[model samples]
Target: MKYLIILSLIIGLSCSERTLLEDYVFDDNDISVVKHEILSSTVNQGYTLHKLNLTSLKWFNELLTNRPIWWHHVYVSVPDNLDSTRPIFYYIDDGRNNETESPSETAKLLSEFSTKCKCITVIQRQIPNQPIIFTADPKSKLRIEDDIIASTFGLFFFNRTLFPNNTYNNVPLLFPMTKAVKRGFDETVKFLKSKNVNFTEKFVVSGASKRGWTSWLITAVDQRVIATMPIVFDLLNWQKNLHIQFKSLGGGYTYATYDYFLVGLTAKLDTKEIREILKLVDPLFYLEKYSGRKFLLFSATEDQFFLPENTKAWWQDLSIQTNNQIYIKRLANVDHYLNQQSKLQIVSDIKVFMDLMHKETSSTRTLPILKWYFENNILFGATRIKLSNLGEFDSYTVTSYSAKTKDKTKIDFRVNYLLDKSFVDSNISWIEAPLIQSKKSDLAAVNEHVYRKLRILSIFNYVGFYLDVNLKLKDSNETLSISTDLNIIPEYYPIGDCYNEECLGKLV
Candidate 1:
């Protein structure tokens, strides 16, 4: 027994030492500074555009840097007659097949807009492997290769020779793409500053789909971006979205699904580890950091990659949490590739959103509020009651009633004005428990149903009164009474007491 204990201790110590060494080695090399060189310049339609290439050298674990990673950039100047003080719109282009669209295309798109702004579209092509050949057509099938895997999952598990991360194997795959984009953007900004460009301090970052996802991350990490517009990108809430996808696909598809960018390498990892990995790359986790920034999310109702419901849910939550800082627009009868009408609508929306941002007026306004309270005695000899609310509201009252007596019960929960989603353990509200019965009676036999209704009013809105009611039984087996009056009063009530006839008459 003594020998076994000693051997176990030695093995445990060795494992701990190995883990510590791995973590230390992984973070050995800090992110390297990037260098940029203007490769070429051209003049088109009264504007001068320059093509710049960026290079950065950094070591990843055991992966030796054979050559510096390269990223390409194209900067288009504002038209000579336009206002130079206008904000710059930086578009992060998705480098597909190592090709970038003509800078003139963007210039033409924004020609109709009144805002005079310079445009810089960045295309990051300097992934570790050049000319990434996908064995399967990405549109038809999911392929697990270095480029896609690295961009989607971060730099965790790829060939050491290609990525060189011998120290930190747990790194997320999306880091490489993020680092490359950030380096390219920073270098472009430096180059523009050196050229003495007279542009506004405001920077708008825009992208679609995969690039859209990157745009969110960039805005979250980089303070330079004041406004962001991401189109046809899902919330990427891994816990909810992944579970929905896995179950919807009959449990056959996972992160390995072609549509998911082949992040299936995480399948072997435990739930906690997977969450940690997602926390590193998933944009949803970082969105809360963008409190002051303007957000415009564009999604198609029938998006093939991201579900529309999930997108709306995320937008709703963001709108509530951020107090209406984010705006979402969903077009009907459109897929991932939006139609011409949807595209035009998006452009119009962008113009309006930008105009709103440029205005000096304060945009903060109270949001529509909805509160709900639920009470029931269903568990083993215990009753659980829950109260929750959404949106910006001033105050709320939860009134409970007994179905048998058809009268207001002693349970009257009230809380002062506050803006929050959770009502659990709220400092303002009070919870009242029912009196204990005699020990002679069987607790299981004393099952009763409870009904609750929540009356919520916003600080500003008066015409729209919100109310919610719920009916629940103490035991799951007990049938609810059909005669339960679940009707909720939707009349506008004043802030103070309206128990008297004169006060009640004043309520419209």
Candidate 2:
């Protein structure tokens, strides 16, 4: 017996030591090295603009600059295997030069993202909206400045061509460099795809002012993007409306020329034509097309031209059409340029959204149904609501009902949920218990049938309060009813009061 015990003890110690050794082993892939590489060849060495078979792109390019040009772009690389598969983001500001190297500027750029995100920084410099091939042009300059002055400014008079019209929904003061931008974006996606990098896991594209417009164009053309952060789109209109101060010469051309060029690109003969065409060019129009996509629109509350009412209109349309995936973020205290605190908040929000996105990529088939509803007025919610394995994915349905009851004058609200085009009639053992005997519950799992029926009660309060109670005397007993037909919508609410699976559920 003693010998057996001794042998067992010896074996246990040996196993423990071996386990520790394995745990301590360091793999080369474990360490992520941040790198910034400047390519030797000209950025647009062999790029071509096949899409601009239209005279419009060529004419527009000519208006900006008559000379032959070469495109410049930067590539940023970060070692894989970080806590999150975060893409090393690179921002090409409004088709401008990409010559930023200051640490403060880099930090400021990085600070725009969420601090909670596991990110390694990378910045790429690229010239915006120029043809992407190296052609034999004697007048073309090799550096960024020479290209601007000689080719764009001096040769083609792009300053005049790129100007905005200052008319509402008219040609923007800054021309849409869509063709050039599309080229860079497609190239980037192809490069990443070749490396087996999936942006669906996490990726962000954002820009301010003119770049904000550029961001909108990019999002409209590309579907692989996970999120978009467009700040102050349609700045020309906003500037004119608010009478805000403006920059004279942006990047390469005079502000006046940029404005003129924008006007010509968006010009329509009349209001009706403009409205019809704007539907295609406007960001709102494309947003409607993105059924399940996520978007964040950051606008200043005090912004003069970009009225809060206009922002609200976009939000309301998105909420009604998208089932609740679009978000509008209003920064109340600051103006167009965000303050330090607002910047931090932007970063934090982006981080949280990215984290949520990463959580979903684990399995494409099933996504945890995030419920933001009210229960007993205490306001409880859950991020992940598991449903029956069979009827998950794009097969969910939502139905809503609203009415005022007669007995005790109460408001009643209900929603019908469907799965895979059919009603989900599963068990609600845990969730039904409270609602049956009691009046409230906060359980994450419910019968597939119950979850389907309860999907349509989104009222934009953040407390996650799923129900509203009104006491009514029916016959001899008291009954409770819920309704969202309220007198006023709160100025702000968590979950954007956006219809997306965000915010609190209302019990009328």
Candidate 3:
């Protein structure tokens, strides 16, 4: 019945001289677009469905070149039982299209141990060239999450060419792209509402690293989302960073959000108009408006690219300015990409927080292990896994794994051991080898002393996990190292403890 009404409503929507569908899609060619690969999955939430899709480079090239394009795939994990109300979890990937999958021991373990009511998934691909925008070609190739437009929790991809000249500066900034992505996101939300999709409840926005910066701006741009979580948040003055990187003037002829170009007054208009536009587009200048939203930011305190002080200042102001609560959890001695245990902790923590906000009951019953298979062969940030306890020792190892996608490698330690300080022993033979990007790296360890106290370090490159470490002792003098893996299992929490589903309104 609701679907019938929604279809009818969509039919009645007045079309502009150029309809949105027509503006983006020209004909069957657009609709029939194919990619190097496409991957998908489905999950059931009470009131909504959730889905994920991974695309290929062909899809990205079409969009980058200003061709009429269709998003490569859609991920639809909707609710099986419509009457019941449960919050939805949505995830999207940013970068060039390349569908690839790898077997991950850590991701699999985390999924297996994660809470049943909550969903953890990914849609990833190898994105080459970091979506550059140069003076010769100033265009945004980033795509919004067109797949799950009907979802209440709309987690879309936010891509921007802040420093158009720096191809390596994939680190996201929070200014211009926010407005464009928010505009599209709000339209999607309006569409869902017209379809009678009940989104009046809590809404959550989340992203990892660059996407995390996008998530931050989304929460600020739209105060409607109840909560936000940006894993390994990275935000810097992109234009300045680019200027420093390429040793030239930053930005380009125009600014772009994803693959679309938006007119910038600096290039196309006067200086006064540029200042006027800056008032609206600058995220830092517009921070006061986001006071009602709650945020849970998870980042490695050790992450170098994203400064802890900067994030702390942002979090502090948000808390002081906002009427709602702010939860800041900084994982000690971790990097931009968390270790296996920390990753599990991230999923568990996020689930608990969302479940509480949504008023959903967490089950005490045992849940089957979920294997989160994300296939995108790109790694962002540092690949070294830093341990909380072994911060003093820069522990490195030669762990072996296979490629999940063309852009990613899978690492499996294949060891059954829990990480502990006692396992550190001198019998461990060690040699440090230079890291390689594509093929297996050298197994020789240069620093023999570092291995005695070292446990493991999983080398990663964007798309997913790449390598694992195995410690074997050949002599009695050598000590064994501890190993740990994360699991995704159901969590048990008390139900119906509070009837304050309207806590958000109370904050207002």
CA lDDT, every prediction?
A: 0.45, 0.35, 0.34
lDDT string, candidate 1, 69-167, tens digits: 434444544454545555566665544324554543433454423223333333343332334333223443322233454433433433324434443
Each candidate structure's TM-score, on Cα atoms with residue i matched to residue i, is 0.55, 0.44, 0.41
Q: Per-residue alpha-carbon lDDT of model 3 for 199-222, expressed as tens digits?
A: 333346666765576666566545
Model 2 compared with the native: what TM-score?
0.44
Candidate 3, residue 67: Cα displacement in angstroms equals: 6.4
Runs off by more than 4 Å, candidate 2: 1-92, 95-108, 111-116, 119-176, 189-202, 234-270, 361-508
Sort by lDDT, top down from the best: 1, 2, 3
| Per-residue lDDT over 251-340 for candidate 2, one digit per residue giving the tens place of the 0 to 100 score | 111122222223332122123433443443456545544455565566653332243334323444555655555554445334555677
Off by over 4 Å in 3: 1-72, 79-83, 98-115, 118-202, 234-282, 359-508
